[model samples]
Target: MPSNDIAPAINETQPSFNLDDYKIIVEGSTSILTPKSEADVFYNPVQQFNRDLSVTCIKAWANLYLNPKQEGKEDIEEPELKKIKIEEKEYIKKFTILEALSATGLRAIRYSKEIPNISKIVANDLLPAAVDTIKRNIEYNKASTNVIPNLANCNAVMYTKEFDCIDLDPYGTVAPFIDAAIQSIKNGGLLLVTCTDLQVLAGQTYPEKCFALYGGSNLMGHDATHESALRLVLGLIKTTAAKYGKYVEPLLSLSIDFYVRVFVRVHNKPIKVKDNMSEQMIGYMCHDCDSIVNQYLGKREERTSKKGKPYIKYGLSKAPTSSTECKVCKSGVQHLVGPMYGGAIHNKDFIKEVLRINKEEHEDNIYKTRKRIEGMLTLAYNELPDTPFYFSPSKLSSILKISVPSLKYIVAGLGSLGYECSLSHAQPSVLKTNADWNTIWYVMKEYVRMKEPNYKVEKLNENATGYRIMTNEDIKLNDSTKSISFEPNDMSYKIEKLRKLKMVRYQENPTRNWGPKAKPN
Candidate 1:
């Protein structure tokens, strides 16, 4: 651990800069002194939502560990819950947090003041200026008792110290620090990570860089590649954890604009790790038809022992194939991406608790993302089980040469056909569903052909899968089969409830060039 104290002489001898150039600002329940000039230090007022969400998530994470309910039991009595709260307070006094790569120390100070459960926080940065600034802010906020400022390489610090919670909100890919973070967090501790390298993860500008950093290729043309970015990050974390006989249970994973964040509980159980090994998968997504197929990197086999007991056998191998060409696309080979996590991204229970906390406790004025949180969480809660990526209805419409239908109609249509579907929070225009590629295309084809004869269906590429669905005369599917007229009250209720929240799904840029701060030259 680096020393928290800096000599007064050292402070005086430091390069001359305007100390008064910075101003004190308040966020959440804590006050922070931030650099007025971006050149001096980095801070983005837009990430208030991210910080607010972090505070709530940390509280929820602490509550989960400090006040766990007995397995397979009913709700606790009010009195018993009160007793649990008392125990929780006692446990909070010992909880420690490490905010690795804390640029401005704002989040660490907030965690100290806002989160009642946090005890000690090590706010670390490699820059001497940032460390000095954090120390000043800690004193200015009167949070010196809990927030410790350290100047050191974050990877080195994380590799040495273990904390109850570890947060890594790095500027770019978190690949280099992931292994150290996995080793630093305590068993069952929460690891909150943020990666702002969306271009490499989601855009077509750098496929080789994506594969090099994340051990997966990018599906450059996929509409929902943002979701793929989330999976790829999860895959990296899972693969890294498995090497140490550990695994991650993702409590909540989110792909906000320009970045992705995941809150996961890392476990140190070899058995559970072995059991969940097959969750990592390599996906083959086709560009032409938006079809996705996943192949498991690790396969499980069950066999009966001599004593007639069943046991699982594990199979592990290197990444299967890295071909950028898709075999499923009929118009030659299309774009393919991944070798990503095929497991559940968000735990329904954790998201529900986050919602509950936000409703009952989180202050909205400061926690501006509260409505967005509710809206996103609700969407995540209603997402189809086992669905990896979503398809954009608008993208499909463009491809099929048809008008885009109502999202409700598409969701209801899929629901009525015994297929699961929901609106995706990742992209408002995208619909997440278990309906196969051909079936979805079939529904679109039939809907457009019947509703608008002016649309030239014959103009669509015949070699593509959507055209196959359009031209398939052997089997016929109409509006009833398409679920266009089916208006189930429950389905409407779920979507309406989310719509009523009226949350801003994406954050508006507070200023020009608002994004992750540039590293020092």
Candidate 2:
């Protein structure tokens, strides 16, 4: 395919195929040559937010390590090995990126035009048409110098070369490419992954298939199954990297609309791989009660020897088995949902840094979804202190047949009880907190029993999961309850602060029938 092989001018034979080319300006910098239709090559307008976020994240990542200052560091010499000292602030100028599945080369071109420190980007695709479209798009955008369009398989190309950054945004599960991606990245590289197979990861239809691909069980019963999906993918990456004496440190992991995206920093450290054991855990979830207990498959404890050397003891050699019955519900058997990455999904400093860049460097209008980014990042930052799994107040209300409480009330009430609480960025109605299911239920029950005296309690014991663990302990409502109040652990004034920044809570459909897009026709 020639660099100028753009679709022929609108004609009877060509039928346009929605091939009308247009320019899209993002972040006040990159101007992408994009097509209107997907009949020839793939392009999703809705995922502009994903692409926009990626640009900022990559820039921040590069600025931190690539363009860093040396402070009192001495070069060490190894007797058995040759020591190579990185020159001060020289290698940081030219960074290489690999976009494994560059359908139309939009992302690659944008990186070239937008990211100042980027030197080269290899945009690859297996489809001949996609390869041709990428080349033409690159030519149209005049990004030929930086983005090299390739006609090759993503995995094959990834396995052959190493890069400072590798992006895997496949149409479905990234399982097949994960190993190759792990091999493709250098010792201290960034890997951004996107998985669109939400049905397999979050849906309950195919447990066996999910296990086969992710080497972990899916939590069909858990309301936050989307989060489990992210963790499952991370677990796969960590396990694959560990096989090569490498480990993954997730900087940011999120469940955006219809898919999951994660940014991870990979490092080569066999000794630190033991940290993954504590980071990986199996979730014991009760189908009846929605109670979740995380049991680590691997355990690590620090010990001191007689010579005063500190060492870690690992106790996880085998896979964990499922429990016969739920610890909370007792009647229902607990479903084993993991062997997934149970570590912190997002790095606070990293996300904060991204937020800072998004605000300080980029303009407000061109980025478009900047406010929502702030809201979401705020929620993510606040939830950092809470546990992994969060309970949905609306789901709990439905189970108990009570009026759904406002998100503010639930959070404030939890805080009053000395428990931390925050809204989940994944789902607006969901609440992430350190309170156990019992305490949550007790609080809700007390609120309901006080407000609606007519509602019967005798019937709840049989149908409501809350009743199974609900105690008669009286929760003294403080004077703060008299007025409608709102407070988040992140110390934000109220949920309104986030909700007021509308359009950030959830993205509006950019077009009709928008979702996991179809392959190029």
Candidate 3:
């Protein structure tokens, strides 16, 4: 960390420069000066949502951990529920944040202005000109008191003191700094990580590179591929922390346009860290139907000791829970895909807190992406917490050669059968539901019967997925059977409920070239 004298030196040093020659970019409460079009890479307009979401998550975490009045879902008395069970002396009332890869110090300055009760902010970069620009901007924005600009290696963060929050938002993979952040963070500290190597992380093009970095196999060409990216990063973080007798509680994990961002809290609990064996899973994913079956490494069961106090006991799961072929659509092959993090990625209670904070604190003009944030977070809160992945209605329909059903119709069918359903924030077209493969296939078959009752089933090959489903006798399904009814008459209400939602669920491209910018010379 930078010394106390550095603050006075920064205040006294008059690096003569005029803000008039630079372009002023205002976002939230901080206005940064960047070199015109040439140096536009210094700031990315694509990450406005990233920054806006960060401010809200930090505030919620602070309220949950720093506030004397305990709030949120966790009970205060539970020893395991305590935010940071580190020694009391290590718990600071005010947060000390470090932005390791601060490009133009825009994000650091925003943190200084947006999040309350911050004792110091260290924005480090390797370029001298960048450091000078940070100092000039701090002076211009009147943020010198909290924002400390440093000229050193962005990863030279192995200092003696630990920070309350450590943000790593490098342009690419954060592999080099994962261990350093894991070791340097104070217990119960927040680590904000961004991986922009969407190609590698999503396993879209290079599955080998994905495995090399994340230690998990890649899942390419799937509806949940983006979420698979998020899980891969989380799995890496979880394994790294577990090695140091720690565990990660993911507050929020998002798969944005071209990157994956996660907000995780690292806590020191040797016993709980063992649960990762159970929390992580290997997935059997079907390429054709987009159906996924998770095979957990282990299982955690609640048991009682001799004295009758409840405790968590970790054990192995039954062998070969799934077969080699896709059970839902018998003709499709099941590929063994993952060693991904299988735990609840979002803490619903924390999401609720974030939503509340956004509504109460962040004004509309300052946080321009407020509505999208609300829509996304609301979808996350409603997601089935135990479900490992999601499937697309279109993919399911394509295999059965049936007319595509509206998203509302799919939701209604599943909801009517007592299965919970929600839209995925990662992919708008996918459905995150608790319905089993058998029920889901039945629903599709039922839809096919109602729509194309007299269609020539004999035309399909015997090995085709549609033909297999039409001949299956276990469910009493046949080519012309119409025995299935959509069980109660009340299912139509689900369609109306979804229709009433008037929220901005996804972002359309605002510019022709709206993605990661090239680094400036």
lDDT of 3 by residue, 1-521 (tens): 32223233267456466766788888999888877665543788868999999999988887786554443533222232223334754433566788888888888999999987787888888888778778878877888888888887755653433677889998789888888788777778789999999889886678878888998875788878888899999999999999999889999998888889999998878888989999889888776566677888899899999999999988888786778777766745887877989989999878999999988888988998898898888778767787877888888777777677777676666665667776788877677777777677877776777767776778888888778776665543343523445543344464446536887667768688899887655
Regions more than 4 Å wrong, model 3: 1-9, 12-15, 71-92, 474-499
RMSD of each: 5.5, 6.8, 4.7
lDDT of 1 by residue, 1-521 (tens): 32223222122233344558777787887777767865676777777778888998888876666445544332212221113146543421256788998877899988998887555788999998888888777777777777888889988887777777889988888999999999887767889989999989999899999999999986687887888899999989998998899878888888886789999988877787885558877666665667666677788889999999999988885574535643333444545567788878988878888889988987677687788787777787777657888988888776666668777666665666767777777887678777776567656765676667787656776765556645656334443434444465456456656656666666667689887767653
Q: Give residue 312's lDDT in candidate 1 (0 to 100).
A: 90
Reference-based lDDT, each prediction? 0.75, 0.73, 0.78
- The superposed Cα distance between candidate 1 and the true structure at residue 502, in angstroms, equals 3.0
Residue pairs that clash (backbone atoms under 3 angstroms), model 2 = 372-504
lDDT of 2 by residue, 332-374 (tens): 6677788898878888877887889888987766676677677
Error of 1 at 388 (Å): 0.4
Give the local distance difference test score of model 3.
0.78
* Two-way TM-score contest, 2 vs 3, winner: 3
What's the TM for model 3?
0.89
